[model samples]
Target: MNFPTKLKKLREEKKLKQQDVADKLGIARTTYASYEQGKREPDHATLVKIADFFGVSLDFLLRDENEDFQDKIFEDEAKRILKDPKTFLAARDGEITPEILDAALEIITEQLKEGRKKKSD
Candidate 1:
């Protein structure tokens, strides 16, 4: 949710050790650990370097996931569901349950994130 959490998550997702990332970024492992531990923050340049290393925008590191970008994902998903005749009719007839909808959205979001990560890789 926050920068430190995101940083640790990104590293874990890449299957890299903290030391590996620190070495790649030319920083001491302890310094990188401090960043991930939320005991310290990186300066702007280092933040940019981290973003570049992860192939993500600074905005992704700095902003909350539940912001506009998340809203856009939901909006786009809703539009897609509306455009599909089967889903549209199901929704109109109240055939789709809320649990089903939530599960669908969660799967879609995960798939989208994976696709984006693959693209970056």
Candidate 2:
């Protein structure tokens, strides 16, 4: 996908609205919408802001590759969470409590167990 499409997809995946992205970038919602629609390109500074806001590399945002980006994306996400712990927590809307993490781990463990059983079978 192109940059605009990628941008839109990422924003949506993060459960963010266009206005939220515009507010973060200090741009008008219409301008941000234009960017998502591929009508206008963002300047370098705006590009940097977008990259940082999304916790992604500019290269990842601009590229169409499926390999090697996952690690960079994870690193960027970790950095972003470290940079703004409150926002990170807020983004989860209280859904990521310790109990949730524990439950998720339990689910993963069960899945692994099932995978191993299948392999043995």
Candidate achieving the largest TM-score: 2
lDDT of 2 by residue, 37-98 (tens): 99999999999999867766788888866665434455555544556657755654533434
List clashing residue pairs in candidate 1. Answer: none
Query: Model 1: how far is 55 from its true place, Å?
Result: 0.6
What local lDDT score does residue 117 receive in model 2, on the 0 to 100 scale? 100
Candidate 2, clashing residue pairs?
none
The TM-score, computed over Cα atoms with residue i paired to residue i, of candidate 1 is 0.55
Model 2 error, position 52 (Å): 0.5
The C-alpha stretches of model 2 lying farther than 4 A from their native spots are 66-72, 75-121
Count backbone overlaps in model 1.
0
Every model's TM-score: 0.55, 0.59
lDDT of 1 at 72: 38
Q: In model 1, how large is the Cα lDDT of residue 92?
A: 35
